[model samples]
Each structure stands twice: as C-alpha cells, then as structure tokens.
Target chain A: MNLPCIVTALPAESRPFFEHFKLQGRELNGLQLYSCERCLLLQTGVGKLAAASKMAALLQECPDITGVVNIGIAGADAPIGTQLVAGCVEDAGSGKRWFPHLPPLRALPDLKSVVVQTHDKPETQYKNGIAFDMEAAGIFSAARGKLDSSSVQCIKVVSDNHSSLVSAIDKSQVFNWMASCIPVVDIMIDLMADPIRDQVRQVDEFTESAAQKVHFTVTQLHQLHRMTTQHLTLCSSLPTLYGSDAKSILQRLKDELAATPLSYTNPMVKDA
Target chain B: MDTIYIEEQISEHPRTLAILKRYPKARLVSIDRYNEVFNNASQNFRKQKQNPALILAKKEGERVLPTPDQYHIGGQHNYYFSHMLNCIYDCRYCFLQGMYRSANYVVFVNYEDFFADIETITAQHKKPSWYFSGYDCDSLALEPITQFVEQCLDAFSEIPQAWLELRTKSTQIRPLLNREAIDNCVVAFSLSPEEIVQAEEHKTASLEKRINALQQLQAHGWKIGLRFDPLIQASEFERLYGRMFEQVLSAIDIEAVHSVSLGPFRLPRDFHKKMIKLYPDSKLLSAQLEYNGTHVSYPESTEKAMIDWCEATLLSRISSEQYFPCVSS
Candidate 1:
C-alpha cells in the first residue's frame, strides 16, 4: 500500500501531527521519521536546504511512497490564525517557483490558498500580500520530480502574520496552532489514503486464485477493477462466475450487468 | 474565480487587460510561457479543480483543424477552433479532464487570429465550411466573461458561406437571445437522461433549464440541434431516454431543429486511464466497458442497444434525413 509522506520543518511543527496519528518515532540518516500504516511524518530541521535534503532522503528510502503533504506553521500577511493553501511556492534567493499541485476533493475545500515566498530568513516588514515560509519551496522542489503536482500539497496555518518576525513569535502559541490543526490534517490524510485503502480492499475481495488463473495484463487488471468497483457501488457486489480466463470473466460480467434492470446510483434519478 | 496566471507575452494584450479587470480580487502571477505552468508535472487534476487557476496566453500553431469525421452533423468540410483549453463545467464524461494536465481554464485572447485562420480555410472550399467553437471548451458557459461567442458571431457574419456551431450544455444564451439569430450559426445543446445528468454531469444546466433555453432560442428563430453524443450507460436507459425525448420533442418544432447527432460514450485508453486516476470512485467510469483497439467504451452489444433504442425512439419522431447516429467516435 502506498502511504502519504508528511514533512514539517520543525519538530515543534511536527508535534501535533505526531500526537494525532500517535506515530512511533524513529531516526533515519539523522532525520526523525514518525509513521503509522497510512502515513509517515518526517521532520526536517530548518531552512530550504535542510527541507530539500531530508525530503529527498525520505522518498529515496520509501520508494513506494505515493505522495507528500508539507505542513508547518507559516508567517503570512493575513490574520495570525488564518489557514492558507499554497498556490505557488517561490524561492526568493534564486527567483525559482513551483506551483504545488493539490488534488480536487482530497484537499480541505474551504481554506484560502495564496502565493507563498520562501525566504532565507523571516521577514518582519514585507507582509502585505503573500505568505513567507522557509521550507515549502525546498520540500516541493525535492518531492516534485518524484510525484505529480496535484499530489504534492504545501499548506499552513498562520502562527504569526505581520505581528512578529520568526524571532519574536511564541513557540507555545505555534504549538497550539499546530495542535488545533490536527483534525484538519487528519481529514487530509483520510482523503488522500482512502483511495489507496479502497484499492487494497478491492484486490483482497477479487480473490487471488481467480487472478492467478486469468493471468490478466496490467490494463486488463485495471479495467476489471474499474468495472468491479462500479458494479459494487451502483448495482451489486461482483459474483463468482464460471470463466476460463480474465477475458471470459469480464465478458460474463458484462452479460450479467446488461441483463440486470436499471438502477440509478444518484437519488435525483429516482426523483426524475 | 480562482487565481489567474498570465504569460509574460500576453500581459499587455487588450483582452487580457479586460479579463484581469473583471477578476480584480484574483492573484495574478506571470510565467515565462503558458506551458511552463499549464504543463507542470505531477499536477493533481482533482485538487486543482477546487480552485482552478485561469491561464491567459497566446496560442501558437494550427489554430483550426479538421474534426474527426465521426463527429459530423450534416456539415461540409468540418473544422473546429478553440479560443480556450479545458472547460468550466466538470462533467465526468468529458474528455477534457484527461486531455490536459491541469483543470485550470486557458483562454487564448487572440480572437482576430483565429478568425483570420478560418478566413483562409473558408476560401479553400467552394461549399460552405463548418467552424465548431466548443471543441475544447464550452461555447457559451463563459460568455459573460470571455464574450467570445459574441465576437465569433460577428466574425462568422462576415463570411456568410461559413457555418458556425457553438456546441454547449450551457443555459447562458442571453448573448444570442439579445441579438438576432444568425442563419449560419447552429447553437447545439447536449442532452442526456436527467438521471445521468444529475449523477455525473456536474455544474451544467439541468434538463428542464436546457429545454427551456432551447424553446426560447427556437422562438427567436434560431436553428438548434440535439447532441445525445457521448451517450452514457445505465440501467433502464431506454425508458429514461424515451421520457427525455418526449419532453424535448414536445418542447420545440423539430422541423426548425437543424439536426440531431448521437454518439456513444468513448475515450482513448490513455484519456480513460487519466480520468480513472482523477476520479477513482466515479460510478460512471466503472460501468461495463469494452476496450476496442486504442479506445474504450460500452461493449458492442451494449452500445448497439443504446443507439438502437435511441434511434428507434428518435427516428420515429424526426425524419431519417435529419438524424445522424455517429457509427464511431
């Protein structure tokens, strides 16, 4: 099963996610890796270079990792507690930019997303229109090549806006912000991981014996999976039918479904 | 309206300036070229959909091309031009979701250039050529913002021999209603059973609203067409489509209707894979499908059943001359 990787710049920023998932923490290559069955939360110390190096290592170690979500406390120009999704992450020093891809329904729908600038240091004065963080560009740039843009999300809740620079911000308050965001983070994890879990469940339900007998190619396997999932959801659970191979089974299923009477999945259809 | 990314070349374009003025609140960022952002790797189709950005750029190369002959509706020398890429509606069956990496809407503001290309193509044919406006995007869904159809109507008017088809599932026909209906243009509306529309065709005008719009357009002397194209598969579809036809035929004068086209739901294998990945849980995508060569669709028997039933139901009402069942799509 492919699991989502969660990366945070600081251990403090990673605490709430760790506490929420109740992950057993371990250290690999001098970086902390906290994980559960569905996800792994990796904490990179500080700054862009650290974020990039640690993220690169984490993905290298977990080659099957599906996607990554980079979460941390960020200083934005908005209210102190405003939650923001990063639409674009710009590295200020080199003027490089990465538009972090977010999945449609998988993201927290109502949060405001904005452009974020990753700086060498915290900005106390330049705070009228965007978000300033130290790690998103690094994490995104590193994870981007290994994943699709939509699968990598860089999101944050405000710890300090224009009120204070990184130096004057309270650590405990950042902890509270991180702690409160646990529920939202959990929701994201569920949205991202549910498809993976469902796919596994489907494979389990499909029966390995029949699969081995059929010797279906990759495309045929996916086609069967798609048909089975739809049938289970809209019509009925797939039944064991007599067939010599995968092709026969698919054809038999088609015959069965075609013979079945019309049943609409959407309730509005019943009304119509 | 989400954030909009601008290409550096088109930042100073007059049309781009007008669009930016409309969405004053949207964050505008500049990229070196349109593809730099639109073609970015690992972009999630579903996530970007929630807050899709608007990418404004200048379209280059082959502005107009021949439509796959299978998509014809009694037009000679059929060609389609897209002022935009991707669409506003999130229809589950649309091929656009799989065709592009990003769900964001990209509008090429160079209207004059597209018309100029059409002008060149029109001169090549002795018979009137057909220009389809909604191949890549809805014809009128963004009419209020782009006002492209309004401009297209004017451009088509100059070449009276050229026919324009603004195919859409949009109820935004005020621009057409406000002006006199042009004889050369056919405003085609896509139709399906309300059950399928509700289940899969998200953010489109309802069946009732579309019929109402068609009735209004007919009243204004516009020639409309019924696009039962991409006919979706479901249980008891005949009963559903039967009732739909009764409602639709009863609503308008079939004689005034320009034509009717019926094509089964089909997509290239690669597009289907992309769509399945984007919408893992979509029941419509999961329906019993047959992989035929490079494309996938309902099994031949099932496809025949759908088209045969619809044809029997429809041809019984309208003449066979005006009805075209697309053999393959």
Candidate 2:
C-alpha cells in the first residue's frame, strides 16, 4: 500500500521514468502499465476524458493502491524547466475545484508550489503564476472516491511558457525535461510514503490466518480483529489460545488484557 | 502554520487582517468558502495534523446550539457555541479526530454573531442560562492569537444572566489576568494524570502548569472549575488519579472553586471506527472497549469502577453540592 502510482498523459512524459525505474510493461485491455518494485506508472493518453477513463480502470484493477501521483509537463507563464507541485487544481470546463492536502515543502526547496488549472484546449492566454495542464484534474477526479486528497497529488514540469507555445513543443524536449526532474520526483515519492507508513494495519497476517481457522460470523470476525489488535498493541504478543470458536477466543483475549490493566503510553510527542 | 486560507468574503475583516499581520511569511490562499478545504473528502486526518493550516472564515447560520443532555455544570438551560472548529492540543482519546475530515483549524471570525445569539437565548429564559465555550475547541489555548476569550468576557459582562464557562487545557491565562475578574465567567481547566498528559495529551500543558494557572486565576478572584471528564484508564489508576487530584486540590482554595465534574471516555460508533483507522497503533484506542450499538467506551463494569473511585475521592475533598457527575447520554 505504500507503493505510489504515477500517471502520465504521454509516453514522452513517462519514457524517462520507465527507463529510470527499469519498469517492465504490459497491456491490460489496451492500457499501458509500467511498474517497478517501488512504484507503478500508467500512460493515460492525451486529454482529460481519456486520462480519467484509463485511471479509473487502473484503480478498479488495483484497488489497494493508496497513493496516486500525476507527473507530466504543463504550460505556465513562468520560465520553462521550472518544476512545481500543485496546491489547488481546477477544471476549467466544468468550473470544479479541488485542494490537495500539501506535504511539507520546507525540505523540498527546489520545487516551486503553484495553483493549477486544467483546460480542454491548448491555452494561448495564460493567467499569471497558474500552471495549465490537461491531465491533473482528470487523474484527481478518477481517484477522488478511492483515495484521500493528500494521497492524490500532482507534480508538473513547465515545458512551455507564455513565450513558447505548447503546440510547437516536441516529445524529445519533453523527455529531456522529465529526465532532469527525476530526482525531485523521487524525493516527492519518498515524502508521500512517510504518512502512508504511519498507517498501521489492525489485522496482521497472523491474525488473519488465525481467524480463517475459526468459524466467525461477520460480527465475530470484527471482534476478533479488535481483540488481536489489542493483544498486539498492549501485550506485544498473541499467546497460545485454546478456544474452539470465535466467541471463546475473543473472551480469552479479553480476559488476558483485563488481568494486565492496559496502561502503556508511548512517550513520543507526535503533535506539532 | 506555513499556509493560511482566507475566505474572500472575510478577507478584509479586521480580525483576519490582524492575524495575517502575525504570519507575514505564510503562504495565503483565497477561497469562496471554508468547507471547500475543511470538508474535502479523503483527507488524511493524521497527516494533516502534522502540519495543520489555519482557515479564517465568517460563520453563517445558527451560531449557537443546545448542549448535549448531560453537558452541564449548574444551569436549568444549557448551550454550547464554538467560534473555532478544531483544537490545538492532540489528545489521542479526543472525539474531534473522529468528527473532522481535515485537521486544519477553522476559526469563525464572526464573534458578534455568536454574542448576539447568546444574548437572544438568554433573554428567552427566565433564570440564568449556561453557555459552554470549549466543547468544540479550547477556549484559551490560542487566546493571544484568536483573542476570543477577551471578546467573550466583554460580551458576557453585558448579559449577566448568561453564564459563560471557558473550559481549557491550555496555560494561556494572560488575557484573564490582565483584566478584572468577572463573577459570571468560570475558567474551567480539564485535568488528567501526568502519565496521561505525557502519553496522550500531546501538545497540552503539563499537570503542574495547569495547577499553577488555575491557582493564579483563583487568586485574581476568578471562579475556577475542575473538569475530569473522559477519565482515562491506566494500570495504576488509583495511584495516578489520586495523586493528580491531591496535587490540584492542595494548590487552590476550595471555597473559590465553582464546580467539579467527571465523566467516562466515550465516542459515537462512527467516530470510534474512524479514529481506530487513523491510529491503529494507539494503545489508548486499542484498550478493551465495550461497543454498544451507538457508542463505544470502557466496558460497563470497568467504567463504573473507575467513576465510582474518582467520584468518592473528589467528593471527599469538595462538598457534594460542588460535585456534578456527567451522565452518559
């Protein structure tokens, strides 16, 4: 679940990534998926509609993927080659808006933070400081129901600016820019992984295997999960249980905890 | 906070202007409404809690609401109002983590509206009406920045029948000490064992600091109250709580105390589920809990035993008339 999925609209934007990660590729129902041990990349084609459809399909295929990152080139008024992480993304066609929970940016000093606006057509007129892209909003919309806002993010490199029109840009230049920005992308992925790592699983492999051996009703299954979670957190280990069913196992766990009188508190101060 | 979100409608508000002046380096973003960020789905509450931002917006609609059935000190009619949405302190057992989607603090800048609502409600009642201020957020934690308690004291000074209780775990009492003590205002401090404070109440003042602040307020002629609600369970419950109570009671004059209340730790069913998912490793949440259909709390027998012990210990020090046991709703 800590593995972050990357979405790119064109192969030019993803070529350097696939080469850098040494990703192996496959075609799943006409969609391209490139993956490595650490990450997954999806080539979502060129527009909002196509990106949305393809990303939605990828999520359905991989439901456990917790993080989605849309990395590609964008047109902005700033200088070309300037990299930025989106603070807010809006769809120009529908006037819908979304704000991503920002990861701490102090550590990533090189990446500029900016607002992004997604458009249906190439933009000749650019707003001051806003990045214009074709795929961020689509990736966000498709992943909206499946992931948390913080887990879904967009990081864009400015390939075309006000002086240079997007139509004149070629794939080779896009690959060069993306290749140079790979380090920043790696940093972003690592930063995003920190929060996901903090999320602990209530049911570990041992607990899941134990439950399978017992005949637990849905309610009993939930109770067993809680009991085992408590046992792991407070007691530090799950002792041998001699119960025939879920009810008896749950009672034994409860009784063991009761005798101990739960009172362990981690001394670490995690609040800011 | 590194970022501050301001609603366009309240961009020019005087309070908002003053606050922005404090953090000139923070990145400011403009929005049409606070909910656009505060209510956004799929926000990781724990992640945002690490670096929470400040959202200043004008609160519209009903600003004052009735308090829960058991949330009262000594009033026939009781109500609670929140000028702020989230708290500065991160207590692991807090229900706020379950209640909110995003961890960003939302401060409603329309204090006059809340005061007007309080005045209106007080006029409708025959006797004095009680108003609780810290149910949703700490009344004094961010006092210097919000300046809310100062404004609230001024407003409550006008409506004598409206009793205002400023419950807090923060040691920010400079504002209260700077002004004359008001009889109608009770500065209530939520107390817990030092062990719990170190483990669970992450950013709050230590037990010793809270006692010092409470005693300072009492000496200034302010009527102080003690709140031990959501009494956390521990292996050495009697020794820890008994010592904490002794430390607090010995420091302050009992005659100046307004009231004392105690209640068990509990949360609505949905909130409990959400919190567990957020902090699966949390020992406080992982403790054996009794899940009735609608809420979760310590097992009934354990809850009863803890409450009975604490109540007896508290009643021994204070008069029965001064003690109020908050019933589970």
Can you tell me the CAPRI class of model 2? acceptable
Choose the strongest candidate by lDDT.
2
Query: How many residue pairs collide in each prediction?
Result: 13, 2
Candidate 2 runs further than 4 Å off = A27-30, A109-112, A168-173, A194-204, A264-272
Candidate 2 chain A worst ten-residue window by lDDT: A263-272
Interface C-alpha RMSD after superposing true interface residues, each candidate, one decimal: 4.4, 5.4
Cα lDDT of candidate 2 equals 0.85
Give candidate 1 regions above 4 Å deviation.
A1-5, A15-24, A27-31, A36-39, A47-49, A60-67, A71-85, A91-96, A102-134, A155-200, A204-227, A234-262, A265-272
Please, what are the lDDT tens digits per residue for candidate 2 over residues B1-329? 67788999999999999999998766677789999999987788898898788999999988889988888887999999999999999999999999999899999998999999999999999999999999889999988889999999999999999999999999999999999998899999999988888889999999889999998999998999999977998887887788889999989998669999998999998999999878877889888787877999888888999999999999889998899899664
DockQ of each: 0.35, 0.41
For model 1, residues B231-289, the per-residue Cα lDDT tens digits are: 88777677778888998999999988899989899999999988877775677776667
